[model samples]
Target: MLHLHILSWILAIILFFAAYQNFSDRQGPSQYFKPLHMVLRVFLLLTLISGGVVFFQTMGGGMAAQYGIKFLLGLITIGLMEMTLAKKKKKKPSRTFFYLVIFFALLTIGMGIWLPMGPISAMFN
Candidate 1:
């Protein structure tokens, strides 16, 4: 479940950039943009679902607060990704949202790594 969540979010981030790049390079909507965006959304949903399952499975494990924080940050990062793409598509300034997405994504990923349920933890074990 943890690996699935991580993989989904990583794919989502990649797809976000790919879609954004495709959208930015063309005056009209690119053929790849919508497909990439749709796939991104799917991965984002998988991320949330997997994350939620992990969260519930690990409830009352004394690190719930930290997990909750990471979850919230992940949610914020997802929202910012959507906002950035929407604003870009409308020819609006999305630079701030783009930066926010980067910041929150990194923060969430860092927290996830630091948590004791992931690859780093497995490595030490």
Candidate 2:
């Protein structure tokens, strides 16, 4: 379950960057990026659900600081991604918004990798 959660989110993050790059290169998101966007959304859903499962199953009743921080950051990351995509769709892409996405993504990914001391981080540490 943890592996699924991590894999899904990592894939989602990669897709997000691809789509964001496409948006940055073009004035707006084209049909080319539409499929990627949809897939990205699906991956995001999977990520959230899996994360929830892991949280409930492993974390028990306590919400540790790392857990809360990761959860909040995950939501913020989703919001930023959606906002950036929406803005691109509306033909009013905000560079600042995308920049925020980049920042949050890097931080969230770092925390995700660093906070987990189980199998997820075992490979690295």
Clashes of each: 0, 0
Model 2 scores worst on lDDT over the 10 consecutive residues at 23-32
What's the TM-score of every candidate structure? Answer: 0.94, 0.81
lDDT of 1 by residue, 1-125 (tens): 88888789889999998988887634856889899889999999999999999888778798999999988998999999999999888988888988899999999989988888867987997
**Per-residue alpha-carbon lDDT of model 2 for 25-108, expressed as tens digits?**
456665668899999999999999988887667565454678778878888988998898888777784678889988998887
Q: lDDT of each model, Cα atoms only?
A: 0.88, 0.80
Off by over 4 Å in 1: none
User: Which pairs, if any, clash in model 2?
Assistant: none
